[model samples]
Target: MSDLHCPARILLVDQRPAGALAERLSRESLAATYDAPVDLDEVADRHRGETVLVVGPLPAEHAHAGGPVVLVEVDADGRRTSPWDVPR
Candidate 1:
């Protein structure tokens, strides 16, 4: 079960949230949460872990100085962007 009051262990930022995926992730006992780009900052602040994996379209702004954030871009076809191509 995910603790809403505490920071999330995994933050899944998907423009189109997939119910099945979110549910599956939660079953693993990790505090997984669904969110959009606009709420990245607010959500990031609530992150119990340091890394964040975005599984859909890239957010307009997701960079923060609070901690290390890892954003992964996934296309409509479910193709993930290469790590080498990700911005520093």
Candidate 2:
């Protein structure tokens, strides 16, 4: 379960390396980290029970696990070009 007062851990699950995107997010005050889909179990253990906020597309297993997955596009200038919400 997620604790409202505790911030959720952020994960960027992309087909390509998201290092630049992660840096941009940091500049925007949204700190995030990236991990291979296969390393998700380690990530979960690292964060304990805190919710994991995943961005971009994920594998079917994580996609259906009930946490929100935000689809966003950040342009070259670090501006979000496309944004949409996927309801649980």
Candidate 3:
């Protein structure tokens, strides 16, 4: 939904504190919010029929949703990238 046509509902999940990131994304008009200190497994059963975006230093997480489970990664320069950014 970030393409500007429709606003997207983004589930911002992190193991540690990520208030800044969540706040920034929300300002952009996306449904961005933080639900931290939650493991992938625990978050899975709680929310259904929504996209799950996991921002992690470790590997990806196991989640449940009607939509896709996206992996969000940030570089040292603070540039964010995702699986969709990868070239086939």
Candidate 4:
């Protein structure tokens, strides 16, 4: 069985490393998660048209990606904020 409605690109992440997210989502069937170094080159080349859910302290580089990039941040107090929405 497969989720036909699921988007081609879906990513879930937190403060942990990119590799951590990739490894965790490995058990799933649709999405593909990979190691995302500070440079983020791997993610750019591999995942082209996916909505990356970076759910933690988003890296500076990711904030400037060419495609659709989502920056999710959770503070120590456990509050979630959209990083891009905050004042620069």
lDDT of each: 0.39, 0.40, 0.36, 0.37
**6-78: candidate 1 lDDT, tens digit per residue:** 3433334434434654454444553343544435545445553433444554453433312223343332233
Clashing residue pairs in candidate 3 (N, C-alpha, C atoms within 3 angstroms)? none
Regions more than 4 Å wrong, model 1: 1-29, 50-56, 61-88
Judged by TM-score relative to the true structure, which candidate is superior, 2 or 3?
2
Q: Which stretches of candidate 4 lie over 4 Å from their true place?
A: 1-30, 34-38, 61-88
Stretches of candidate 2 off by over 4 Å are 1-8, 15-24, 28-32, 48-57, 63-88
Please give the lDDT score for candidate 1: 0.39
Clashing pairs in 1: none
Question: Tens digits of per-residue lDDT for model 3 on 1-88?
Answer: 1232222223443343345644433444333334554454344333222334544433334242212223432222322323322111
Better of 2 and 4 by TM-score: 2
Q: Which prediction has more favorable lDDT, 3 or 4? A: 4
Give Cα distance to truth, residue 44, candidate 1, Å: 1.5
Give the better candidate number (1 or 4) by TM-score.
Answer: 1
Tens digits of per-residue lDDT, candidate 2, 1-88, equal: 4333333344444443345554444444333355444455454444442434344466654444333333323222322212223322
Backbone clashes in model 2: 0
| Worst 10 contiguous positions by lDDT, candidate 2 | 74-83
Let me know the TM-score candidate 1 reaches against the reference structure: 0.30
On residues 1-88, what C-alpha lDDT tens digit does candidate 4 reach at each position?
A: 3233332333424444345444543444533444444334343334443434334434554444322234332222332323232111
